[model samples]
Target: MSFKRVFKQFSGSTLPRFFGSDKEVDEFSQKYQYDPKEKLGEGQFAKVYKAYGKDDGLEYAVKVVDKRSLSNLDREGLKLEIQVLEEVDHPNIVKLHETFEMKGKIILVLELVKGGELFDRIVAKESYSERDAASVIQKVAAALKYCHERKIVHRDLKPENLLLVSETDDTSVKLADFGFAAFCHDELDDGCGTLVYVAPEILRGRKYRTSPDMWSLGVITYILLCGYPPFFDTDQEALSKKIIKGKYKFRQEDWQNISEDAKDFIRGLLKRDPEARMTAEDVLEHPWISNLAAVPDLPLSTMQKELREFLAKERMRKALGAVIAINRLRNTLNAFAFNDVDGDDDGDDDGEEGEEVREEDI
Candidate 1:
């Protein structure tokens, strides 16, 4: 894995065509069309290079994939990926400008986004501030919504898959790394998606749905606020167990300054049971995400007892319900211990005739 910082300041007067079907321009050689500049990044899938249109001077990201490197991969997988990309079109998703084969290597020309991988930013900065975190996730949510609407599930939605292509002006949170992307109607590979971020159902090798994408989003959200994955462990077996078990922690030290709504969002999406997890639409309507200003604070009452109560006993969520229930019950008096006769005045026990009372006292 590698990273690059792109600034989308296009000086081109004409609106750029997002996708071009014209792969063969016999009038222009492949190298004549795009001037490949600096190497943007390298990955198992392909090497990203900064390219500029020789005649148009427009910037682009060209992914170079040498067939020799991927000896194990087949042509059908490539076709599926291209088909998936063609079917998906969203602002947050990396735009496929063009594709062409040359020199026994396939090239994917895309919009050059330079913000680097989102995970890199979080790790480099230790953690994302509340506003920054909000901005990042909003773009992700938009991308996922677009994919889900088209019946395309990005099976692998790790942070590295998210790219930032700008620093100041042409800013965007574009989704990249679509090698594992597949259609919901397609047969799934048991070992698909990243292990650390894969949903529990996928780990169990079961037939699942789009919930895994939500699970990955939850993991990304957790990492954004807390600086690391929620259920991560070093040992492969242990990590696998934790992921399959869907165990998570909301340590105050780790989650300080983060909003209650944010936590709630993570908890619901990361639930062990796929059915219990929130859908893409539900996430869009969630308080924290829907209202940018609705992020919770500690001093305020929102993250206080009511919020805690909501968490503890909220009908639809299971994240911090246990702790909230305990805290909520603390305010409770536990009246189960009180005898009803002590407070009853409708009819006194002494007023009851034939009541067997004086037998056992010695």
Candidate 2:
């Protein structure tokens, strides 16, 4: 029922480090001019909190990692995430505002993604229209392409890791959570990444060049369009087996109505060999996405059925925020149907994303 039982044998491998990296920022880091205002979420060693910047109106999600957890060697992983995040200036990737060592802990001041995780939206709708799904896929593909070109690999790519700023439909996909990520130039000694999203070669402990993220993107695209993942295991061992074999059938109800190009795209991404699978550039250029208008769009419901989506998400976010705040949150999320990530607001080719992450290689 957990990641432990599923990859227990691999536990002696590098898998454990992936999940263990979320260190509590409170341990050694202290916010200057910013105090934790709201607790957003908690991981094994870290807690994401909303903080207000001193002298600035901007709000940031401060990721606090306990210094005690980061051994001399582990500091490199933390450094890897920070350095890579700052260096990768892509619209789809989350923006890193600032990172500094406070006391002994490391504090990562990042963009406060208000809309939360994409999984919430996916689970709420139970499925997505192809057009909408394609848009999300395209944005992610672009980001992955940027990362791949730089020899960076986002080992973890899943709905939960995909943080959002607005939920305005097809416009809100921002790739977030780079904690388990690693560089392509570095040794692939660590089989680090989420279990469900890990590509087959990664699980088998084989050397892979790239395309693991594409496999994850494929899984995300399929789930967005079909309401559930292609694989599931009440037990981790079974899940691993399912992952290695792709042991599931596409139902007539899901696949019949969906486009064949989309299916082919997913199949290409799900290739077992990392070398054989479609690249991020190839995915972005795929007919399913590039030729989106060519495909027949699904019909929209005009009745009370149309209202169901709003009602469902409203119900879901109620417990998470105040009534008025939640309503505003809903509208803002809806606006993400067209949020600008490549906004050259400052006129520099390196946008607010590049500026926000000051310590990047760029």
Please give each candidate's TM-score.
Answer: 0.70, 0.71
| Residue 13 local lDDT, model 2 | 20
lDDT of each: 0.60, 0.62
Candidate 1 residue-wise lDDT, 6-53, digit = tens: 113222333222222344334235443543457888866578888777
- Identify the runs in model 2 with alpha carbons over 4 angstroms from their true place: 1-32, 125-127, 186-189, 299-362
Count clashing residue pairs per candidate.
5, 13
Task: Kindly list the per-residue Cα lDDT of model 2 for residues 1-362, writing each as its tens digit.
Answer: 12223233442323233232223334223333454567888776677787877556677787888866766456556666776787777767888876655444556777777776775654455444568778778888888888888888888897777766676654467888887777787547356666556675565555665667888897777666665556554334445544655434555654677787977887778765466678988987899989878765673222113234433543465455423322232233333312332341121212111111111111
Residue 263, candidate 2: C-alpha displacement in angstroms: 0.6
**Top-lDDT candidate index:** 2
Instruction: Give, for candidate 1, the lowest lDDT window spanning 10 residues.
Output: 1-10
List where candidate 1 sits over 4 angstroms from the true fold.
1-37, 123-127, 169-171, 186-189, 296-362
Q: What is the C-alpha RMSD of each candidate to the true structure, in Å?
A: 17.9, 16.3
